[model samples]
Target: MNTAGEHMISEIVGYISELVPIHVDKTKTELSSIMTKYHVTKVENEDVHPDLTEKIQLFLSSKRLEGLAERTLDGYAMELRIFADHVKKKADNITSADIRVFLGNFPNLKMSTVGKKLFALKSFFGWLAGEELIKRDPTAKLKPPKTEKRLPKALTIEELELLRESCKTVRERAFIEVFYATGCRLSEIQKLNVSDINFQSMSCKVIGKGNKEREVYLSFKALFHLKKYLQSRNDDCEALFVTQRKPYRRLTGRGIQREVKNISRNCGLEDKVHVHVLRHTFATLTLNQGADIVAIQEILGHSDPSTTQRYARITEERKREQHKKYLVL
Candidate 1:
């Protein structure tokens, strides 16, 4: 493989990174054709002057600083395409006014959905601004909807106990413990191969959004459940979690989500308990247990402390802890 070809294809990070090396053995002419077809040109610096669509594609394609699961990348791609078409059709410099107008025009969108679309715009514009393609970051003054800052919906101590009682089945326990303990995303958990778990260290390696990788620690309880789940597994499958549905197979992210809801319902919890909420529960529970916010960021594979701090902000334990210290020491 030529230099650029080898560099571009083989450098993927994630569970895939741990696998066989990339098949970048394209002929020099083939590589040249690809570079030409894409109109990819290297700037003086380590940058490319790709078009709006290609730029976003490149931004997504290039390695992520904080790894993420592939499904997340797909979602980001979908969101970006939506935003790209929106902005491009209306003409660029797609200001905050444009964003608000576009969203407002689409009255069918819920605020949460609006917020997600806005976030995708923010990421898109931020990248454009980085390349000096845009004069200003239109999303600079943009605000996500002021949805109620309710404490992240979580399984209460008792509800968790109920989940324990109701989640007696093997897969249920595995789902609960793994999410509550490691805080890995549903996609990450679903994509997890048994090889990723280091039982001796009680750590599970996760590939997070953007193809970033991090090691999430498993509690003793979670580790035990994982071991048990593995023991019950057939050697034919390599996935850490699998389904009981006939012709049993590796579970998908949706599978885990459905299981979370089933477990939540059977335990009599009215609220839905998706994998993310369980992950949120893990973060908040760890914080309440006095884990450092920065440490939690690492465990959760968040690139920015501010992102991890969102989980902390939604909770009172951090503030209450601060108040008590002022009273004495």
Candidate 2:
């Protein structure tokens, strides 16, 4: 029998079973026999359009060709894949209402997370419209959630000193020093080659987001620890930092994070210490020391001066505290 015929028979059997109060065993046997004879199949939604998949590939290729970092490309791909799966439709067929519904479903997510997802969708749909693949951008009407402004956390000078002292190995000390000195992103530091650093000048070239290269300087203390670390290494991996094991591979971002956490715990720090906090510490300290915002922007590889201005705000807060203590009214 066809699917409709089989479905009708199952419904009839279900009503009969409920009405007659037949034994469960007999009902199961009868249902099994009917299913075997009819060969009923599970229903599934239609597959997403081939054009949608093709467009996604093209978008990724464009990002690669535009010199986006690998990690950034991976994020874009993952975000778009999730959005596509949630919608389960072609890009052109997606509607603003559908996107609103999808985003609304993620109620438990942080505002920043929801904003990131919305930004990804907006970028993807914008690209589709630009390429003329879609008549209208579905995400055009969507607005990202407003996230609360939180100050970046920076370690105190004493805490930094204690953290550095807690490092038992030359490698760990060097890792912490470089992170605090350069203010580079975790991925930028992880991708650093040995040749990128200049010991005499106390500076290194880092590839920031969009594969943009910038120079970041190191402090005398950072240079000293880094030199010590390098002198202790026996491998020829060419990476600035490597694992301690044999065949020493380059250290990954996660490895560096774990090392930082271990050092933080050893130092008895109650607050979390990660690569980004180290960066915030660098920027905050530099601003307090009277470094110009533009110079901080260059050191931190921030494309926008406004991003570097957060440290200036920190400085203002410090000044306000000092004024409160010193003013005699």
Candidate 3:
């Protein structure tokens, strides 16, 4: 949503965000009460058209389109409200200048945060243009700011060896191998079912972002651990990965992150060993072994080559060693 409406709408948003356990379907009366309490209505009286709210609700509920996730739909609504305030209240027609004004205020924002807002505006205006709601797109000219090309943290070969050697449970080994083999996002991996695995080919079929399906290969060691884990699985449950706890639902991203951290700590590894690190490790190692960068991009299911190029960059150790050989400094 646009910046002005944000203050009023956010005050009206349920105390706990919808991303958390808080209920998102609060009454307009409840929203008005919140606005009154916060005195946000006084400052932003023209913000968030009530008709636009109904339209957004209808759009989110329709399964024929994207934006299904509850958290995502909520965020989109908030973003649209912000945009509507900025656009509809404009004295003159909205243009790239208005968009520039919105983006220009984010100098103090973190790169990730700035990226999200830009993405929100882009999507909102794109939707408006698609529906013929707008004659022209204000966000059409917006550009994502270039974020620093910091390499993802990955375990060194020795650190990986140490961690792999430290694993006493077959479950731990399976988690590590699956992460490295698939390079799937944590959310994708968490949602994997037993049917997603190809036992004969030793590959995993993952539902990636945008609901795209991609196949990722497994190593011999990865397959070994997976097979071992499968032997202990309950036939009644279809989940590829399950916790030891009762009710036996899917494992969460947080659960996997904690497991990786515990394993890293136990093995005395210095690097932070999260799931994304495992994916980066796979990409880096594969690129180092002469695998094509484009192939790595496909394997990791990245739509952009620029995203994969970060993996193609040399490691710090390699750069330091190269400087030693030059001896000019």
Q: Would you list the C-alpha lDDT of every candidate in the order shown?
A: 0.72, 0.85, 0.73
The TM-scores of all predictions, comma-separated, are 0.68, 0.82, 0.71
Candidates in descending TM-score order: 2, 3, 1
Against the true structure, whose lDDT is highest? 2
- Please list the residue runs of candidate 3 whose C-alpha ends up more than 4 Å from where it truly belongs after superposition: 1-47, 58-107, 268-271, 315-329
lDDT (0-100) at residue 162 of candidate 2? 92
lDDT of 3 by residue, 83-200 (tens): 6666554322557876777667768988877777778778766776777766777777777878885777766688778888777788888998888887778878888888888889
Supply the global lDDT for candidate 3.
0.73
Q: For residues 103-142, could you state the per-residue lDDT of candidate 2 as single tens digits?
A: 8889999999989989988888899899898999988888
Model 1 agreement with the true structure over 1-329: per-residue lDDT tens digits: 34554454334332343675643444434555665444322223322222556767766765244454456567778887766665553224467887887778667867788888888778777877777767788788988986655566666567677787788687689888888888887777888888888988888788777676788888899888878878887666777887886677788778778888888888677475677888888887777767899999988888888777767643476677778888765
Measured with C-alpha atoms, the lDDT of residue 217 in candidate 2 is: 92
Model 1: lDDT to the true structure: 0.72
Angstrom error at residue 54, model 1: 6.7
